[model samples]
Target chain A: MSESLQVNTMADLMAQGKKPEVLFWVGCAGSFDDRAKKITRAFVKILNNVGVNFAILGTEESCTGDPAKRAGNEFLFQMQAMSNIQVLNGYEVKKIVTTCPHCFNTLKNEYPGLGGNYEVMHHSQFLQKLMEEGKLKIEGGEFKGKKISFHDPCYLGRANGEYEAPRNLLQELDAELVELKRCKTQGLCCGAGGAQMFKEAEPGKKEINIERMEDVEEAKPDIVAVGCPFCMTMMTDGVKTKEKEDSIKVYDLAELIAESNKL
Target chain B: MGISNIFFIIALAAAGFWFAKNLNKIIRNINLGKDIDRGDSKAERWKKMFMVAIGQSKMVKKPISGALHIAVYVGFVIINIEMLEIVIDGIFGTHRVLAEPLGSFYNILIGSFEILAFLVLISCLIFLIRRNVLKVKRFGFREMLGWPKTDANIILIVEIMLMSAFLKMNAADYVLQQRGVEHYIQAGAFPISGSLIVPLYESFSTGFLIFVERVSWWFHIIGVLLFLNYLPYSKHFHIILAFPNVFFSKLDPKGKFTNMEAVTKEVKLMFDPEADPYAAPAEPEGPVERFGAKDVQDLTWKQLMDAYSCTECGRCTEQCPAAQTGKLLSPRKIMMDTRDRLEEVGKNIAKHGADHSDGKSLLGDYILEEELWACTTCNACTEACPVMIDPLSIIMDMRRSLIMEDSKAPAEITNMLNNIENNGAPWQFSQTDRANWVNEG
Candidate 1:
């Protein structure tokens, strides 16, 4: 599925004096986590099908230092951020799109303070923009009339004030988009933000993701769509914990859209 | 001037002096925190202050509570305008001084105040029931025990008494005026008091009605003065600080954790090739700067003000994922603890000198490491705060102190931080393998 993919490195594109319209920042999770990597491929497939000009930083990209920053290690966060800024500025990158909300948040909001300014968008926003521009066409396909629920990523929804793009994209897929009880500004966390993804949750009556899954069960959607890799991991685990993985599915927004487009 | 007039002056003077002294101490306690400039945006701040504080905009997010609260809040503020007349009447030994000059306008003002006071009384009764009988989930959290619970009830009870006294005073005055008694002018309208309450006083003697009017008037004024003095000690302090707290709210995106400039300088120095490695430091080293907050004194002044401004409404804790799912980290508790610790520190300083130590700090003594680690940093608490308090920032600051200063973090967090430093990502994968997903078949 992935071998025939055509991807350009920022270095290669710069060598040819050709700049892509956007830099696809494949974040740490999108690059390394096997499950998130598929979401990355799915988004890339849609991008390729639409023929939107985009390039990846490939090995030149490192962690955006989001986890370290969130975990209260400002020294390490700045070290990573300063290096990334140097590399980004060297490329004269003007725009960025990422599948990860953490990367999108860090690069878009936290980077400018450290002198790495760019127009950054989450892939859902980017895809929604492409649809708005009449460049990308999505048919209902398998998603027609299917009950889908979107788990809002904290960084995307509350953190960045973006609650529309992913939902708009889902609407384009012709899915019966239902909302979880706590959504938008009141959305529950997947228990994976603030570096909690890499650690066990503190002792509690229930895991945060389990609590979120209860909301999902109340909505009773056939599939849970997530815009964040952390949310994806937690929701997938949540579905497993409920022992309903076979009956219910959790898919990233890009993956769902890609399947709908048959990319 | 008469003896009662002098006594009223003495009461007013004493209340004003104590209130001023307490306000000065509060200012000093808040200033003990590190300063940050939230003065960058003046126009935007004023707009927010008017909208959120003056307009009570955000409170309306929860319709029932919001409407009830606005009734009480508006009643309290609007009724206080009557205090001006009360002071003049008490000091000059006059009755309704604005009555003759303002004419029927005074009637409209008093009539509206009477209606508002009735609403306020009703709202306070309902709030008491919500807190005690129905046990609203937010108000019943573990942190709302003891004084916190009693503080809310006391304020409501006090407000109920104050409004009742106001209506009774109007009702008695109306009855005396109807009887054409000496010095009881028919000045202001009393829609609620005159219609509902005056009948109860109608059968009383004119002399007895005069006694009721005088006693009610004195009680109302003294209650208002006592409430004023009580502001600094109670979470009711929010009534005054909410304006400034909302005005200085974080204007940036909620996700943007502040970039530490001190860390940036050090990182820049490390990366600078042209700089001398062995050069003497440019500035003489001052007291070692703590990386993040260990106590209220280490927090920003705005944060300390946030502590003061918290209504202990539990709105933040209600929205917190950890608290909702039974984690020890109640965002409301965080603010309450900060305020409680600040008060302790302020008292210690008052007893001893400015540098006095309480032998306890906000972090270990008040806020537990377990609670600090429980936050997901989702900003729901900040979003849910009607006055825009950022308890998440305080949690993050304390987390920073725990990790960077004390090197005391959950083992998993230490591992995660180490991985990010060593392997670029917050996992053990090599940086060389970052692009391996591209060619995976």
Candidate 2:
């Protein structure tokens, strides 16, 4: 197998040479699920190829409490946030990064309020940086003829403004990057944030996720490129509902990068 | 007694005149803490006011308020001609050649407005109380109370007086006919003269019927004109401005402002990923302090005018989650402040020796910063303003100033922004696994 064919886990990542002073906080979205283990490992390896040598600061990781805050449970939100902040501050970590938009949103947008201010960057942004620096080498132009569409996570796009990095990386992969009108600033919420991710969505005329997923259908792509893990999960469910699960694929931006290696 | 009667008549007449005039002046004052930066021309103000105020356009949205307001507005306008007869009869005697058509039409309108104005007034009072009273009954009223309560209240009194005038005129006719002297003065210089003032008219006559009619006429006519002239100065001003505000409403989509004055980082980044994220954002920027309205004066003149224009309808407060759930938010207060400020400023400006030669004015202290920040930018208040005052815009600019420049906001929200700058998510997540959600979730 090619050296790049094999991926490394967070344990292996630290065992390898570390270049930067940072701790990667694995969010509940990743820590809680096993499939997330697969995509995250892929992202970790992609990060290595990209020159990020930070150790996983998983020990200090805690829920950002955005879900509680947005759920109108202010007290619970404060409790969760304060505890997370104490641990993060105790680890004395200065910078952070994450894949879950919820974690990203809370850490970057919600946590600093609780006194855990740290430099946060989405994994997509970090990877896009690697691609630009020629650290994450690409091999396959095979998907050149295939069509792809990018699903912008609501927090990272409309909320935080990290809309383009993932799509630019995709375009470099030589896939036809189709655009959706509701893609960026006007990006529709996946009905998963503001704690909607955990609780039953307050009933409305139509489900927000369903509304967003329908917007995705119009792009008519062979694959839907996504950045945040929640978006991948949500859009995957959307793809299943439309029963286009097989024909249409949801690839995390990192997964796309890994798949692009053409090994 | 007749001497005292004349004095009674003059005193009521003088007070009514003063009240109406002062109302015009007062409605033009009350600072709303917005920035109505004399940017638009008189023509623009007139254009907005004409289409919005004179047009009675906004009310059309609330099928009930709009339809009722339209009827009341039309009735009020037609009642304008009706007032001409009352004033002429009060100051002099007889309604002149104009009284012929007005007499019959006034009766016809009694039924329309007697029923309609009463409903609008009662409904509006329910709203007025809803905004301040803090109750549940306000729920059913669609929260209609507002500064226009001034208009509606006056309208109610006017309707009652106008209705009474119709009733009194007919009752006098009844008294005169019963006394057997319809031929003596039906169209004479004294429509309700000596013989017409029989025992029935006498008891009521001893009271200031003429004086009351005169006061009511002044209230009706003066209220209409001053309200008209002050149309751009108040919240019910929307009852006038709504048509225009709606017509010019940012038809693009909900949640987008009218103008996209500059490119965002996404565009800049697309063009040059090397660009700094802190670069200035586009839209109404050069002299403007923030993206959202920084203060009351920051509001468009139409919005400043919307305070006066607001009918005091509490729909905005009713639908507002923060307000509904007991947060210290009231859309009516914001709208009222605009008119209130203008009225106050108008008084100061019109004061005998005030100093505003440079016109470098602040909206003063009408809206509290706390009030400004309390807004959730939910747009419900704007949606319910009846006049289309878009209070959210005023608030957003203030937020922009506080957040972008002053770095001010609730410590919680600011902390979130700090979390954003520090952590990839609002949590203390591992940066390496930002993509972990893809694999795990």
Q: Per-chain TM-score of chain B, candidate 1? A: 0.98
Q: Return the TM-score for candidate 2, rounded to 2 decimals.
A: 0.46
Interface quality of candidate 1 as DockQ: 0.82
Model 1 misses residue A150 by how many Å? 1.3
* Predictions in order: lDDT: 0.92, 0.55
Please give the DockQ score of every candidate, comma-separated: 0.82, 0.04
lDDT of 2 by residue, B96-206 (tens): 335356576544544443444444445545544543465544333322444344554454454444444443444444444444552313332223323333345656542
**C-alpha lDDT (0 to 100) for residue B53 of candidate 1:** 93
**Maximum-lDDT candidate:** 1
- The TM-score between candidate 1 and the true structure equals 0.98
* Candidate 2 runs further than 4 Å off: A1-263, B1-74, B84-159, B173-252, B258-294, B341-374, B419-435
Compose the digit string of candidate 1's lDDT tens values, residues A200-227.
Answer: 8888899999999999999999999999
lDDT per residue for candidate 1 within B106-215, as digits (tens), equals 99999999999999999999999999999999998889999999999999999999999999999999998888888988788888998899989999998888899889
